[model samples]
Target: MVSKSSPHKSALKEKEGISQPESIGKNSVAQIIQFRKQQPSAQELIDGILKGDKISLSRAITLVESTQPKHLEKANEIIQACLPYSNNSVRIGITGVPGVGKSTFIEAFGRFLTAFGKKVAVLAVDPSSTISHGSILGDKTRMEELVKDENAYIRPSASGETLGGVARKTRETIILCEACGFDTIIIETVGVGQSETAVHSMVDFFLLLKISGAGDELQGIKRGIMEMADAIVINKADGDNIKKARMAKTEFNRALHLFPPKSSGWQPKVTTCSAITHDGIAEIWEMISEYLILTKDNGYFSERRKDQNQHWLLETINEQLKNHFFEHPEIKNLLEENKKAVHDNEISPFAAASILLEKYFR
Candidate 1:
């Protein structure tokens, strides 16, 4: 079926010195140039996001998370524009010790929400290697069902330069997701010390996913985290594990009752569920709805958000001040010089730090 001078035939016969059209190469180069020249403006990104464009939403989050100084102004502009449309979504923080089925639970819970006509966004934080500063970033691969769903958005961010398995820019990413019409935003944290506190500060509800017979009942979860949890879910409560899960649930409930009353006046609940079997998922969501209603009715919801905003303002100031001190060229030089002196016992650690601080201030 080959024509005498078909382009496909010519391409196949290319080694014979048949001249293919140079237009193809020229056009590709032109397209590349055009793409580079046409980065979307802030308003354009905002418009695309408002129209529920997922690609634009991803780009906006990338912009916010960018470390390049050149992108700062544009990122700020995009955030300011999106701010008017944001803060309407319910933000949930999910955390669990390793092997606790956090991904499975999220897949089940997210799909459940999306089935009822809600758009869900999952911001999963992956821990980066301390040496290489690289992350597996495979959360999407783990949540196969939710990853395939059209109503769901799963963004896995590297927990670089931030401890506790959360990206430094997660709070900003939440705003971008909310502005893009995602009704539910789930924040997954690295289940390490101090990470729960960070996640608790930014979410409407914090849920701790636990499994039964995981050695110790507390399983390294700090007491402060127990005090902050809005709900504790005992996952993997199916097959032969049902009895242990139920016992774990009972124990958790009893322990929760001993904690001081929450400021919201709503008692935290503990329940058992199987993410694989999809059992008791609905009950957990119903509890979430009830908590939302109660908190909203008591006017605690708004107050909590206001308090979070205030907390972030101070947190931002502290982070920026630290970054400025470290990034300063003179301070960097002084630090290296003084750190060596301290290592060799030429100067005390306190004196070295004081010298660096004086140099930073001056």
Candidate 2:
């Protein structure tokens, strides 16, 4: 039989060992909570955004983009707090060929808008590697003038594991920008063909920027993007390629006529612009404003926004399900085993996937 004194001493030692660390952990957590409370809350960030403060917008976007667990909770809180003020801005998505001067055009356009007393926020979606899931946030460096402007906010974000050039956080960032009272939100995307669709889905206006003489006019853009574009601007119009730009514009105009009208009932327009000389930037903005006016007047604005919101809800649910499924330890083990089986041809790839999925469902 064990001695009463021995058991009590053992229990006391156990308590001493465990309780001290637990107390320290609790204190540390309490300190962290106190620090967080002393720091800016999401409500304060929203207030700053509504005041058109660029620093606040930057901080809010960073919070939304962070992958940390605590930051995710904070981001959600910030988004919820800002939701009432969001969706009030004109969201425009811009895409173009690799060398078509997307950043330059955005800088010029952003500067132009700021000059006219409009608050503009640029959210650039950098391409991410499918294999490594990394991105080079190069747009902020490229858009030097826009980054320095008091009325303009520039955020370059990564697409991470998302397939589209647009980052998963981009939609949230747009809402934050809108909450901050930015009148216009410009989403810049890598000009990869199908990736532009991601940008198209979230914005009110989808602008396709193309340079003249890149290749055959007909095949310059993939069919899907051309079909989605609200406007196609032929850039490099001010230089020696002015004549070629005109020809390209004519070809695009004719090409656009063949596609079905947009769901918004506003006909797509093709124009020419030179970002190097800052020419036709105002015209492009005017075209966008006109398109917005027409869509809003025809009641398509609200309809499109509603559809986007529903789509976002479904997207969020799907993403969460995917994350949850992948996070399960059993599912992960089965997936690895299945991948090896598929590699070794022990079972057909589809059969392996079905078997693993059955296990997951079970």
TM-scores across all candidates? 0.90, 0.84
Q: Write the per-residue lDDT of candidate 2 for residues 1-362, one digit (tens) a residue.
A: 77777734443345434455665687898998897677587778777877877777788788877767678788898888888988888999999878889999999889999998999989887878888878888898999888988888888888776776564588898998888778899998877756687788899999988988887587645788888889999887996888999999988888888888777888898899888898888899899989989999999999999998888888888876777778778999889988998899888988987887788788
Evaluated at residue 106, the lDDT of candidate 1 is: 97
Each prediction's number of clashing residue pairs = 0, 1
Candidate number with greatest lDDT: 1
- Global Cα lDDT for candidate 1: 0.89
27-77, model 1: which lDDT tens digit per residue? 888998998788788888999999999989988888888877667678888
Model 2 stretches with alpha carbons more than 4 Å out = 1-44, 130-132
lDDT of each: 0.89, 0.84
**lDDT score, candidate 1, position 222:** 64
Where model 1 places Cα greater than 4 Å from the true spot, the runs are 1-38, 218-221
